[model samples]
Target: MIKSGITDSRSFPAVSIHGDLVITGGGLSGVCCAITAARQGLKVVLVQDRPVLGGNASSEVRLWILGATSHMGNNNRWAREGGVVDEILVENTYRNPEGNPVIFDMVLLDKVVKETNITLLLNTAVYAVDKKDMATIQSLHAFCSQNQTTYTLTAPLFCDASGDGVVGFLSGAAFRMGAESQEEFGEKFAPSAVYGELLGHSLYFYSKDTGKPVVFTPPDFALKDITKIPRFKTFNAQESGCKLWWIEYGGRRDTVHDTEEIKWELWKVVYGVWDYIKNSGNFPEAATLTLEWVGAIPGKRESRRFEGDYMMTQQDIVEQRWHEDAVAFGGWSVDLHPADGVFSEKPGCNQWHSKGIYQIPYRSLYSKNIHNLFLGGRIISASHVAFASTRVMATAAYVSQAAGMAAALCIEKNILPADIFNQYHIPSLQQRLLKTGQYIPGLVLQDEQDLVGKAVISASSELLLTAFPGATQVTPLTLSVAQLLPLDKGTVPSFTFQADAQENTVLEVALRSSSKPGNYTPDITLATQHIPVHPGHNVLEIQFPVELETAAYVFITFMKNPLVALHVTEKRVTGILSVFNSVNKAVSNYGRQTPPEDIGMEAFEFWCPQRRPGGQNIAVQCDAGIHRFKAANISNGIDRPTHQPNAWVADWNDPQPQLILTWSQPQQIRYIDLFLDADYDHPMESVLMTHPENVMPFCVRNYRIKDAAGNILADKKDNYQTHNRIYFAALVTTDRLIIELEHPSATVPAAVFAVRCYGGEVGQQL
Candidate 1:
């Protein structure tokens, strides 16, 4: 059928495209996949049928982005999706807290366009696929309505992130729709028998007050008798936007085939509801209120869920079942809606939350029969009950990140996607994910090439000599004296101390060069100063100049003020000045800002002891056993919470805790990643809630990097939050390098999760 293009052909001209990866759908999941893959240096073609990106969360649907944390409710706590999804949440939280759908569209657009490797095709709907023996997809044809062009994109791999499972359907991938029988997955919430009816679609509207009397007129299509709608009995003019998620339809029929009918019905409901508010004369607030926007397309919920290598079940979520190949996690509740949607006489949806979070295995991301087909978003392989929780945009984003990374690795290894798991290739995959800041619960990364694992470890403070677990109980104690320091400087410049203020008050501090430098307690008061402080746990510093030539011991003392209290611990170290007993009174652990409840005395030591049970030394020094803070743990890649606590902590005397990586020979290192334990105590909030203190108080405020020759490489200062990873400007070859950290807060000791170095090996990137 080859015809001369100059005269004989009047048909639509076809365009051809090629890439390493082709993704169908432009929702949150597809966008995440494309960004991640393209950043890994892969050519990606992201095709979407919609005019704008962000599927249901787009301007067309206007649904708010909801995710695993369940709006920070259900005690899910800090369980927000932390990878690419977190990038969106953090950026949106900082840029668009008011939650404007239009602004969100721009945020997503900016993220996609910034990646040079991604070729985004908007308003291009893929309706057909070319498959190789029904096992692998070779290419797909899409029609771009905006440009009136037909494009065929070919790739080695394909992902069906389209919410409706359109690509999978054309490829003939095994899929299920609607509710399943209770006996199928043993799901308590499933219907007694299988049914094709599915969860319906929802429409939303935005309204604002114009501050003037506004008139209203109802179209003929508007529902005249609003009393027929049951949910409207309590509806008022004040409701609109996300508050109206209950405005739904199309669950009782084919969701895709009946989209027009569903949209028209939703229109009637929306206009009818507005008519009642404006003309029914029931509410006075409607007199000046005007409709800002109404969603043109309904945000559809449940649809075709393609079958994968493994299917997630409700039992797995409820029991928090562990998976060997787990690549992501979900904390959202098992949310299921009625087949009748808004018209249902029963409640719209039923939900049950998990105790914490459940694992999502990689097996659930690819098609069971198709060789190169992977899935993301709501269409991922799962039973109806399991799909309820994983369908949220945030949770789906994590799945997309995992799939994208896996695809990159698959291409690099010249292996099929399924071989990544079958051939025991998960360790490398997991490590790469963690390096990119994708956190997986209970997984720890161990670097075999870290030369610091062979060095001798030592510190400047003697208060770190306690056992790994430290004291079993907190003891009440107090400190009257502190460590003596011998410095090359003739004068003692400055020092910081931790104190708990019973109220807003001040504590008097005195520093003296110890006549007896070997003594732990203050021998002589050289200088006395008064320091003003605030309530709560605080680290305050005092500066004064007291010249003392030759070797000197600095003795510090505090006035016995009841308004301020210092921390005491049983953990002890050597070769540095320490605190001496000032007062001993047994007090309950209750009402204390910090913990080690039984260890606090009337007088306390300057060094704070963190409770850690398991860690191995990375250095060979005799005092290495005494220095409980292992340097190797910095890059072991386990991100534990403050309560569960897996962190490397140094004594309070040293402002800089340095991790030195040394080798017998030079080691080439081009990248250094530092994961600081940002004291993850507070839950992640999806709304505009601000805390009195910055997030992760224990995170380093500033730092400097130096090589063995004492050359400064990089000095980062005044940092907030945590650095996922920092790449060096160029490769450095040396016997050793050091990372020195400054405490973010005076009260707490510096904590770090991992310090990772990358180089010396080929192909080390995503």
Candidate 2:
């Protein structure tokens, strides 16, 4: 290599790249957006300022990703965000069950690089925006410190997902940084000035045990007195990394311009806390522990929120309001933190949950001022109160996926972003998102192009819910537990349960259901029974004197009784679960949420499911079987369970389960999409928590597709994902198709949510 002579001035190498869509962040939201657009035939350029993707989820920050499921702490059933984000999360669970942050980084990188249509720029920060006109961005100018080069990225559509809305700021997009007044949006839960108008930044640290004593020397900048932190007493030797999410700072100051100051303050807090843990002699167990990693950057919570066509508010979330142009959904509680962060005497956070998942409209995704600009992640147009719920990584990714799809439609129709809704294209957009496994609340796929609608579907056997065989396991009734059963409009069925009582006691049993059919709140009590139990064994007969007018999920609740233990079954099925009315400290669930009357938050009990290796169903037997799982449900257009069990579940006793689809005439078929069960109730946190199993227990591990002549078209093995798309080498003309499936486990039944067939050109698998 030849060295150039020093001159008065020198410039770094300049490069220009062009694409159909340009995304300005590499967080989960931006990564999902890029992948979605790229799959929909749009050339995408993903520009990330950091060395790795996942932003706060990367090893540098190490915050676990959470969304609607809220660690399975609320009533939102089967509520995980789908599409590209689901794929990433599912894949991460399959490959990285240990949830190592560094492994998560590799998963994101692998997904982005696999998409040929996506051009990813790592360690590149966008500094300048070039406008084609007053309201449209023509290109962006970015500099990569590692490469020492400047890049000019040009695209017709741009998505600003940077944590601080960097592109939106440079492009003059209208944005709000602080919380709005209570009167501005009529938000009763809006924070007052004393409580702080903005959320703060958080830094995390990890510690390791060396089996021997380790010395810790405090830095000059380390905080001297840990007592200054009000909640310092709550810290313990076992809690490290994101478990100490309360260690936050820099909310009173400008979060964007003063990020460095905020990070330094957070650093001081972390080092000082560690100093107290290691040198304070308070934690004897931490004597052999050493600092493994400390976050280099703080995880930002609130920043500049760019304005779009519509702004989501508190009422939209609390009321679970429906949107005409709904594209995404959010279910996390409205969680807010104090501006003083760790130093404040106030509690760590204020979280208020809604009864059900709320729909996000398409109007809140694009910048109103900048014509070609799309706002994503925490920067999406939403009031401060609403942003608290939508700011989570999974929800952000779900919303960003919609924006990416809208961008693709813009290119295909040669129209602007707003024109998509104005021209009655929202239905088409919704269908496309559904095809890719994106779940919009209360929406079902209605694609007329799918040939499955024209076929008569039949299954070898359908599950008749009569009983869940009891195993050797028996769980104590420490907290109230309920068995969720989907029932039709009729008299409640008589159920029998096997229970063991330590002493003679009266076991209170109640039948309940959600006021809203689609939700799982279990707020309305239908009937109650006080059953007298014996000391050793009891076969309790539960009969409710109630009749239902409509079909819904009824909850058979057995109230908390320390003296009783109920039998639990190992048998797992689709659209069925056992929930408990208890506290999940991780999500702020405290048995029942009793918010202030004027806060505009609902007061209800939290009925949530437990995770695997323990969340077994309660053993029950019924006189009349509930036949809800029908063969025709495979073509019902709904992918996940909603108000009813919208799935075809085979009986557990069926030796070889199969589904056959027969048409009137021979038709050319090239593609088939199978939607299976992936246990959506599990939160599947991206990092810091280990999952029990790599594959979801309800997914079909092996399946085969055969044509009319019994020739195998596709044979899939060890499938763990929810969406399975099969493409044939060429078009095959057949009047009938048979799908043979193997259950994921002997105890779990084989279930399918939907099966869609299409006649199209064969393409590479996505």
Candidate 3:
């Protein structure tokens, strides 16, 4: 150990370690940052201050994992986070359905241990940083209490996902704390003037019934009068865990420096509240309930927010602005709280929901001044209002994943984060993220490597005629609804649609193509036709001939004057979906009156019959059973999960589903990556409950891979989860590859998201 700063007055002992990237946090975002970088073959040293990996969601704090889904409520449907967040949620729901905090710890720890490139340092707190120059970090110094050893870790890049932006703060990076003035960012939701007040911290408790009489003894520090608390009216004895997020404090001062004091104050409130429930309870039902646990550490909400190239504002979220460098997306409402917390007479929080998902630009994930510094989680660059929406665990994880990948690319290409976008590597970064199964809203994965995209693509079944037996009656008047129809170069002469008119109505139908291939909704109008319809069930035909340069989606819309009842079928296609929009209604959820329905945020989601795969689509087709859920989705490189139906699935009656890939010439391949459908019926919520099955019913439980020569390459009988990567023993050059799938149950079908193949030499390994 080389000691430099040693004098007669003072001596310091230092130990040195080296890595490519150093992450100073073990929270969800930090864990994801380390895992993503490590997976890309970068040596990462993750130094977490806590004993466990998860920071807020750990046993010590017991905060539930909240994200873009907003607990599957609040109208933000089908927006669960992907990548590492998805993996953790699936594993936890399958293994520990009750949402046990201890089990959750193991799940997080297991994933970190599985990655060989990551060096984890638990109980190590990074408090200081060494800078090489004014713009870059050189090393980090952290103390591990368990080993009583101080570590000096050096790296080329560093990520401050420590929830408070500690590394960046110590390195003298520019940052902002508390709320900004309305004039500064022009955020209408912001305060009139700047202030140091923040969102505060929370500590939760857990309790369960013992089915017997129980007694509680209140400590001396417990508040004797519960009536004095403003939020006491909403307090319930049965409330535990996340339900107690309202019990917060320390927003009036520095949330980080005064955490210990805040923790003590929270303990008093929690115990006092429990005492009110157990002893002062007006009902006898609480006699059998006992306090299971209480958090000793407070889960902080906000502290020092690092400065980035872009500062996301409330206007950006409310307007749903699409950024050119958007690498991740968020949909959670802008949830801001009063600084007084529980002591305040006001409600716990103020929330403003978005009409749809919004983009989080990559520019906000890296430091503005420190060249090699990247920050994520609660500390990313954003105003108090914008941070309110992006501070959730899952959104932060996505940002962390993007930052880690960008760091890897920075090392791989030998450039800075800003240079990545400057050199036109944003597309490359997005492609890598998409290939890895992270869904970026409004972005399509046009995989050039997918051989199917090169050929004349066709499906086994493209037209959906039959609606589910129980269909919802939707009468859309003045509003238009449309579905994406994948059309080839061949002209589609005409298409049929089903509708039940209450009375005589004139229906205007139009065929529109997507303005851009990546966009989901149809923007450019191609043709229009008017059809007179009578009452009762009517099969209307609209003659529309269309030709495309490439195989892409052509949308057909029906506009009803008097709200004609449309029949929705049960079948849903992977890429094809139904969309609706109206110019009549304005956004009404937020408290403040704001202009609504911009051209971009005009599309509104409507619930249709949960159909069989491709069961309700109205399109012109050449074959009878050519299912729209085709093998092409496997190579399309989009994995939007099982619930959204952006995956390939077989017919229910088809006993065996076999997908075969053939090339004109022999191709050498070594790796085959598969993304299966894990049922997303189980929602992410604060309350814990178990689902019927860990794996989805339609998932391919049994599968086998074979070559054209009839040689078995790989097989698995009882498959589970959504992702699998299989590497062959040696490079196998073959023209044809076959994959046969079987359902776990006789009634269920089979499905897959993507099937990616890589080319390499015989000696190559993954």
Candidate 4:
């Protein structure tokens, strides 16, 4: 091609990031696939037509992010567990600040960029495919709307995460759309015979506050019927409620051809449905509720089900069978929109799942005839019957992650996508999935050494793995991501670790399983952590205090899904960010920092305040109330309850995750102490150490502590123990302090009831 004289500033028409794997479409499934592949150490390229990332659930659309968490016993999909789906849930919780959507979008979008490993190209539409044959999809051509440019992309493996299965169709890969006859896939949800009708797409919206109610008028044919949406003789005979009514007949009418027309129809349906909600008087406030959004992009429930090596039928889902090659899990129902085009063939078309969730086989994720091509999102190898449940965004995320990881593997190993199927690489894929924080019960990290790869960047110089700085005998420290540590509040505690050296290196750190005893896989879970150490460390931080019933095994494994995890993460730094003074555990360095220490430091101390001590500042009248630190009594170590007892300020407290006394000083503090003694004459004298053993103490200096309060003093730590106990002690200074605790934290629960000065003094906190 000769260079046209249309001199432009563009360096290149479209430059592919040249990832080992390439995924077209940056929607939920596509994002998952991209991230999964990147995490596995493969270069990944993801292109999306939309400006935003999420296809179904985005702030642009105001769609809710739903998961398997429900107390009402709503039936859930089994294969929906773990993987990208779980990661979203964990993020959604933090995003719903004010328990609302504004924050959710901020977090969700951030996560898409932060969590996954794929290079994302937004506002790029894939126009054509360059597939040589079923086994080899050479390249994809796309037109970028942003700068009005055309480009080509090539990869060893390809994933079609577009809800419509656009690439699958363009590539000449076998695919099916619409509903099948009941006999076709043996899906009870399917029509008795085939027809052009479909279950009509949705145009979901959201609203919270006041705004002018918008109005919409249906077209001449808007009266076309559906079970939920009926045509009335009143107007153009159009009544709205989930209006996919006329959406039947995409067989001869391609979904892409009908996209714009369907998009318009969806708008009418959305406004019409909301009109009913307002006029019906079901919700008076809804009248003022703003039309935050209508599903901007019409989400196709049924599109191309690519024929993989194995096809998962509704029977497999209903039977709750386990496939040796299962990569993702899901459970919603076998919902087939009436293929007859009758919107309301039956009052309700959904066939509720027998259980909340089901295991989805791995074979369905890849093309049977195509070698290096995998499919994620809703277009997997299931017939119309099982897809209704599988089509949801959460389930699709998990599947996409798997597909992305598998695609990455294919690119790296020069293997075809077919080889990444259930029997061949299912275990490896499962392990990889877990590395991205997707969890499956049966799958374990096969090899700790083999699990290391790209996500874990090696460190340049020697840095402590502890949160802050130097470590002392008494400091209780958590994760050590170089200079990053869990903050007291506000921003979520997450950071990316970079390998110090240029050459590839595996990240490694010393970790201990803190799960409690007698529980299923330990409940207190930590945020999904990635290490660029020599090996991947794949396992939840399951913590358990004494009196707690369960704990996960102290497993230290590697991730297998995203193969780049083989490099694992390393926690090493060149210089110290802060120093702690162990002598008096105080804010000596808060004003100025000059490294307040000699080679052998002593008495440099700081104190984190405890409640109402010296019988002043604060007081609790009741003996019944207990200390509830956020990490203390946790369901999964995050959400803590709020209290409003005017006299005493009560922050959300749980006994375990432990109260952080971050110390950012200029020197190392080795001798710090906590004063834990019951107020004998206090009003609630009876409440003396209901669980004294909760008061486990440790020493932390400059390189170890996470605070600038100097240093905290406690003889030793009691990690996880079972005992109804009370705490009563004082921090004492000694040249060389030693205790019989023998690092007791391992066997004892971590709890600290009250921190005051030695004797009856309440000055600085402990």
Candidate 5:
């Protein structure tokens, strides 16, 4: 190599790439979008400004990824976001249970590079856009600072997921910066100017014990006056990283243009906080602690929100409104932080949860002015009130997956993004998304090409829920608890529960269910009964004289009684859980939310399940056994549980559990997709949270597929993912296909959600 002397201004190496789609940003949203599109047969170019992917979820920012599950802090039971994002989360849990930020970076990189159809350009920032017309982008000009190269990327479709809406801004897309007024969208929860119009930026740091005394010296620019922060007294030596999410700033200022200035202020705060912990006499435990990592950039919460065909409003989220063109769903609470951030005297954030998960329309995912531009991440069209709910990484990733799939369809049909919604192509879009394990609220898979619909399905043994053996452990009834039971459109089953009372007292039993059929809010009280208890063990029968109109999940609630203790079992089943009316401070739950009448928010008690190693099932016996887990459920079109248990669960004692599908005639099958249970109830936060197990306990660990002639078609071991697709080199003609499965744990029965088979030429992986 020879060194060249600079003469006139020299340009760096330039490269041009042409693809079917171009995505700006490497956050979870953009990364999932690229993966989804690439898998659907689109050539994609992904441009990320940072050295690593995941944006705020990256090692630099280190914010944990969350979505509808909401840390299992709300009533969204089995409400995890699906498709590519689910895969990423499951993979992270398997590889990095400790939630190491650096390992999470590797997980994202591994997922992106494995997609052969995607060209990932890291450390590349898109600075300019060339438009074919005023309404369409023709190409993008990007520069990679790390490699000193310039790239011109051209694509038929463009998605702006850059967090700041860089591509949308450069392309002249319609956008709004601050919150909308109450009169603008009839959103009573909309904040006033005095309360702050935008959410702020946050920086995080990590601290670790060195096993010895460690001294810290603050920089010259460090914040010397910690007392200036109104909430400085809340900080402690044990809390670090996102636990200090209230340490935010830069909301009143321009979030986009003043990011650098905002970051400096955050740095000063972090160093100052550390200095206070090291030097302040109150935190004696921090003597052995040292700063392990400090974020270089702030995690921005709000920036430019682009305008799409339809703008989501507060009612859409609070009312759980349905959309005919719905392609994705979100369940996180409407969380908004104070604009004054750390310097404010107000509470860190105000969060309001809905009764259930809500659907997101396709019309809100593409630009209104820029014809070829698609919006993803926090930039999707939504009012500030709605954005508070959809801004989380997992929700953004889910919405972006829908955008990516829509882009593939647009390229295949040679149509614009709006045409997909206008021309009645939404049903086809929903079906395609469902086939890939993307759950759209109130929608079931109706694929005509699936061969399982034509087959006769049978299982070795189906689980008949008659009783859960008790005498394992007794939990005090300090908080009201409920057992969720799937029921049919008939008389409600009478439950017999064993409980011990410290003194002679009356136990109140209530039967409740959500007003909506499929939701788990327990908002409607169907019936109530009073049962008398003695000082010793007593068997009590709870009989609800109510009849169900449709299949639903009913809750048998036992009111809190300090004198009573109920028996619980270790046995766990698919699509069944027990919840308590308790508070989880992390999600702002306080047992019951009592807002002022003028806030336009509903007041309700939070009934949520506890994390594993604690959330055991309430032991109960039914007068009549519920036989919903039949062999035919494997072909029911629904993958996850909704109003009822949609899975074919084997008997607890079945030694050789198998699911068989037999066609009338020999069918040539080349692809088989199996949907298993991954415990969707678990939030599986990507960082700073430790999980009880790497794999979900309900998952099928070992499985094998066999043909009519007993030939082993495919064998898998140590499996954890929910959706498993098996591809064959050549089509196998078989009238019968047998699936043998082993339960991951003896306590959890083997279960299969759905089985789909396809014949002929190989198409998309899904």
Candidate 6:
């Protein structure tokens, strides 16, 4: 480690280029392995040939990451690990609210490189593997395109995530290709025949945003192909938040062998399809879309794979069978395109059918013949029938993360890749998985210890299931009483009740409400019918048929639109930033071209230190020199901000701009994070440094801060760089705090930052 006093400014690598785990292929699987290993605090080197991450889904290629979330209509269930897959959800859910491809790729790259334990090599490809006996991969030789250099990596465990089982093939691992007869895997979708052909690949494109038109040019052919117009409607000229273009599936031919040709053909169809639409005057709104992504990537739907200890079959997926060491799940169906799908005689017969979530055994990920090697993504051991159920991005991510985590564990234990699975500690290792918010729905433990335990309903319809060390069932309890009152049951639930006749005319009962403050609700009601009934934790939601009298303290309950969008902008600040839109109840996240159609889960979130025992707020963050409180246009102020979370702003000036904060934590929070700038041009409220009533006296020197009582609280010089941040500590709870800032110059109008609260601090664990 560099000495703090050295003061030398230089970037350094985290691990040796050669280590105990050499993961080949930079696709989703390889990236997942890199992420999982890093999170486990293991040294991992992630190599990728592409300049940017995300393989086929990268902005450079332009494909939405369709994970298992859409498995109902297709064959795409992937069972493996959830660590990396969940990270995608977490990152996209918050960072790129619009699901921007540029941001998505950036996020993937950042997650891989930012891990202190990971060494990420971009624009590099593993050319060959040096083996120490056939059972182990000794070193991998890789060439970096940009640097014009070669690098070698040595790892005890190696994962092939090239999406085509490239590592296994290069290492001489046993592999298989081509479709098998239906009897081989007992699959309804699999023909009773074997075929040399493969499923087709799609070249996806989309518009920049809605409400904009860009004249599109068609193919170079003199005459247009008008005969095949309706055949493309289900996928073409459709618009919702944004429009998609040229969503064509081609390449019924050998995908890998014809990758380059497929990409070119896909593009030709792209312009040709648009031309047909423009000339025919079909899709009156045809010109309103732009070709944002021309699908430059060749996503091979079928390819080479290492034969694993267990070859996953259609039966396993159909039965949802979980192995003792099961790490992933799948649900996409067996969707085999006709061998000549590009010129099929029949429509839709090009797509075979199978449905329901399927289970993927962990053994399917590693090579049965190759000792140290593992595979992920479309390259894993799946008979064509089972591969159909695992090809989606989500399932791929799950499998990749599991392989990565297993690799890391193997590196640490100095064991072979198969050792982890064979050991009894698999459950504990899986426990490491569950703690990170990944779900193992059908995990069957070899240790006879079960993770399923008492399930409790979270304030919102969220579930807070507890993991019982070893238990069978943990049902959620629901409030199922027909009537309960001081006179009816034991005693009426005592509390001051307020009813708004104008808002919620019908009184309704609620299951539970979040204690996250600002989220409290008097009229929040969750319908009992819709909420799944967990055995033990169901909150009864009974609603009154008619409006309740003002005098009648409600018997039932209801969920009403918040008078205004209410959320804690910053959990660590001492002031408030309000957004009360007169037009709508919610605030649209600006900057994001794609706004969510629904509110609710898309609700805003903030981070701060956790509350301490004395009921005292944890910290206070504020802007110092020149910052003001301004509410741009927040719904004409129907109500004033109350129980307001505070905010801090950074000056537009100063060689170093910062929003200074100070707090005392006796403990920590689960996670600490901050909301990024959404770029709402007309922000409802600018962040401010309010003078609190019980303010602490503090002194400032240059940029350093000191408590009036003479204790060093917080400081800022030119040392810290800033974009926007709410610093916090995990497992650390703070007490009273003081916040200040420095608006260095006039060019910097009052720096605007908002929503600050005091709570335990945490970071993005996902």
Q: Tell me how far the alpha carbon of residue 642 in candidate 6 is from the true structure, in angstroms, after superposition.
A: 36
Q: Give lDDT tens digits, candidate 1, residues 1-766.
A: 8865567556566999999889999998999899888878889999999989888877788766666555433323346566676667556654665666777789899989999889999999998999878698999999998788999999989999999889999999999988776677877666433222477889888888999999889789998888777777879887667668778788787898888899999999899899899998888878999888888888989889989889998877766778988898887767777777677766666566554577898999999988898898888888888898888877887898889888888888888788889999988888777666677776765657554454443333322422222222221123343433333345555555456776787677777543322222233567888888687776666676777665433445565576766653332221222333222111111111122322111121222112122111111112212333444445555654311234466666675677666667777777776766543322333322333343445567787878889998778876554444556657777777777776665545566666666664444453
Candidate models: Cα lDDT each: 0.68, 0.92, 0.73, 0.44, 0.93, 0.46
Candidate 1 backbone clash number: 30
For residues 359-454, what per-residue lDDT tens digits would candidate 5 score against the true structure?
999999999999999999989999999999999999999999999999999998999899999898899899899999999989999888999999
lDDT by residue for model 6 over 402-521, one digit each (tens)? Answer: 777777667667776667777765666665554443445543222122111111101101111111112122111111111111011111222222222223122233433122222211
Model 3 residue 560 lDDT score: 46
Give the clashing pairs for model 2: none
Order the candidate numbers by lDDT, best to worst.
5, 2, 3, 1, 6, 4
Per-candidate TM vs. native?
Answer: 0.73, 0.98, 0.81, 0.54, 0.99, 0.57
Error of 1 at 286 (Å): 3.4
The candidate with the higher TM-score, 4 or 6, is: 6
- Misplaced by over 4 Å in model 2 are 470-472, 762-766
Task: Rank the models by TM-score, top first.
Answer: 5, 2, 3, 1, 6, 4
Error of 5 at 250 (Å): 0.6
Q: How far in Å is the alpha carbon of 485 misplaced in model 1?
A: 33
Tally clashes: model 6. 74
* Model 1: residues with Cα > 4 Å off, grouped in runs: 1-9, 192-197, 236-239, 449-633, 640-643, 648-666, 676-703, 715-723, 735-751, 760-766
Q: Write the per-residue lDDT of candidate 2 for residues 1-766, one digit (tens) a residue.
A: 9988878998999999999999999999999999999998999999999999998888889999999999999999999999999989999999999999999999999999999999999999999999998899999999999999999999999999998999999999999998999999999998989989889999999999999999999899999999999988887888877888999888799999999999999999999999999999999999999999999999999989989999999999989999999999999999999989999899899999999899999999999999999988989999999999999999999999999999999999998898888899999999999888898988888889899999999999999999985455789999899999888898988999999998889999999999875889999999999999899988888889999999889999999999999988999889999999888988889999999999999999998888888878999888798888998988777788887889999998899899999999998998899999887888899999999998999999999999999999999999999889887788989999999999788899999999999897767333
Tens-digit lDDT track of model 4 for 230-267: 43212221222122233332222456567677667666
The weakest ten consecutive residues by lDDT in model 6 span: 680-689
